[model samples]
Target: MSIVAIIEFDEAGVATGSRLGDAATPVLRVDDLGPTRGDGVFETASLVHGNVQALEAHLARFVQSAAMLELPRPDVEIWRDAVRAVAASLTSQGVTSGSIKFVLTRGVEGSGVPTGWVLGTASPDFTRERTDGIRVVLLDRGYRHDVPQTAPWLLAGAKTLSYAVNRAAQREAARRGADDVLFVSSDGYLLEGPTSSLLLRLGSRLVTPRVDLGILAGTTQADLFTWAESAGYATGYELLTPDDLESADAAWLVSSVRHVAPVRSVDGRHRAVDGELTGRLNAALDARTS
Candidate 1:
């Protein structure tokens, strides 16, 4: 089952209130720019038990995305309330694991009002991917590593509603007999996964690609880094390449809902999987309360 909360915004685009409604009900106008031109931003947060993990991080990124699209700033307090309310409702229905996605759109064309809503749904079991691991292919993202700086107009790092390319990349991965994709810059620098962040274990150090490479700073990766640091693992961000990935002791694609999915192979080339460390990582992720 799914739940929805339609956020009511004032003329200034400040969230004034929200109403719980059936997820299947039609709420958006036919002319909404979100569906039409994909002119909007969104954030999906993991819901574990009754807690919304990395909520503040998600909200911060949400506002950042909206600013990138020049949409009105989201009122954090109201949006937080709506998200928690929906999360609580889903938990009440006995959902222990799920996801909550909140979105803000540039409303119907020329309406001068933005449409917003929060949708929550139970999560699918990903035990196999988290344990058995997945295969991935490195696909060129058609942008240079410095795209975020050179072409900010492309909204490289922002998590916007425009994701046709991302979906297409996943489909292309399937056609290639891979489970997922790791996008490389046209210039041959390691970037990130379509919907996830790249993490590599280089000896005792845990590293990820630099955020400057037009990748969404991973909320899940941030949380895991914190725990990893506490657990005596060193962490850092760097400009990486396929050679770096090839040399890593182990690697994963981390995200909000899926947590950590170990990459078992790259382009059908078998890679080592650190089962012990992967278990520890997922355990730490599942234990997050804030």
Candidate 2:
């Protein structure tokens, strides 16, 4: 059974209706650019204990993405109402822990308005990966790290819904018997996972790829860094390479719902698991979100 709720929205971002646990329900028009041309922006937020986590941050990013794509600015209040309505509806349907996805797309072919909605779905079980860690492989993203600065038209950092390439990379990783992929730039700078941000520990300081490297600024990474810093750990946003990851005491792929999953190996180069650090990081993340 599909444990997902699809909520449709009107121009004012009000919920028109909802279909629960039905994946075959037609939610978007065939002419919608989101499906036809992949012209849209989205955010997946963890909904814990009936509260949407980091909603404001996600909204801000969604608005920024809309502006970057030349789409109309989303009315936050309308979106707020729609999201709360959907969340409340899902809660009534017995969803205690799940994810809320916000989507805004260029509307039906020539409609001149954007299509928007919020979807609530049960979170995937990542217990084994989180507990045992994951094996990852590095793949070239086929672009330089500075491409975002050099060409704004590429829509870098926009969180657009054009994810075919990212999905394909993950599929290739699975084919190679790896759990996930870490995208590296043509110049060999480590970037990020398909749906996550990369972070590695260097002695007492934690380092992640620079935002200028054309990667999405991870909200989970930001939260972890803030908590970790106050708890007496230094952090850095610097260019990192595969060699740096191999040398780190530990590394993780951080995302909103998945929390933190340790990287057990990279390109089959095994590293010792720092279970203590992973536990502490997860503890900090839980404390903040809980």
TM-score of 2: 0.91
Candidate 2, residue 216: how far the Cα is off, in Å: 0.4
Worst 10-residue lDDT window for candidate 1 reads: 9-18
> What's the lDDT of the predicted structure labeled candidate 1?
0.95
lDDT of 1 by residue, 202-274 (tens): 9999999999888999999999999999999999999999999999999999999999999999999999999
Give the per-residue lDDT digits (tens) of candidate 2, residues 35-147: 99999999888776677777788888888888999887877776766666667767777776678888889888677767767777778887787778999999999999999
Clash counts for the predictions, in order: 0, 0
Model 1 alpha-carbon drift over 4 Å, by segment = none
RMSD of 2: 2.8
Q: What is the lDDT for 77 in model 1?
A: 88
Scored against the true structure, residue 164 in model 1 reaches a CA lDDT of: 96
**The candidate that achieves the highest lDDT relative to the unseen native structure:** 1
- The true-versus-predicted C-alpha distance at residue 284 of model 1, in Å, is 0.3
